[model samples]
Target: MSIPNEALQKILQEIGQKKAFAEQQLAIVKQQMAVKTRENRMLQLTASEVDSLPGDTNVYEGVGKMFVCTPIPDVQKRIASESEEINADMSNLQKKQDYLEKTYENSKQSLEQVLRGGGS
Candidate 1:
């Protein structure tokens, strides 16, 4: 059966709204992925730098809002642990980004189909 113009317009509008929302979500996911990637890189670099330092090297680590004096050995261990956590976070965010990309593509395709009057 042929669809009514009003119903088709309504379907197109809903698809347009969903498409816009999905685009925003995708943007947010990308921003979060970038932040996670940066954190992962910095953690790796910090761990590498700490590894190269002499065992007697003096270093301070941030505890919450303040940097506390910590022994080089302790700093090294903390860096190693933090690096692992950051890597895990990066992996999770990567997966999330992949999912979001797929969702964004589907939303775009749906919008295109609706615009072409291929309402479902």
Candidate 2:
């Protein structure tokens, strides 16, 4: 038995929707990754700059609208921790991007097959 024309159209439409949704999600994930990567880079640079300063030099960390005087070692530790968190976030986003890419490809393939009269 073969799928009726109406049902086939519906199937095709559904696949198309899935493909579009996946594309949107992939774009968002990429944007998020970019932001996180930039933040991580800045943190790395700040850590390096802070490390070069004399131990006696005062360091300030931004807290809300004010900069709170903090120790060099404390600033370094905070930067390191923030970098780690951003790295983890980027890794998770990468995994999600991979999955969305695969999903989009599969949807495209299925849509092509259906359009070519190869789908049941």
Task: Tell me, by TM-score, which candidate is best.
Answer: 2
Q: What is the alpha-carbon lDDT of model 1 when measured against the actual structure?
A: 0.78
Backbone collisions counted per model: 0, 0
Candidate 2: segments with Cα more than 4 A from true spot: 118-120
* Candidate 1 structure, TM-score to reference: 0.79
List model 1 lDDT by residue over 11-85, tens digit each. Answer: 878877876777787788778878877877887888788788888778888789998889977776777787788
lDDT of 2 by residue, 3-113 (tens): 898999899999999999999999999999999989998998998899899999998888899999999988888898998899889989999999999999999999998
Candidate 2 clashes: the total is 0
**Candidate 1's error at 88, in angstroms?**
2.3
Task: Give lDDT: candidate 1, residue 107.
Answer: 74
Q: What is the C-alpha lDDT of each candidate?
A: 0.78, 0.92
Per-model RMSD to reference: 2.6, 1.6
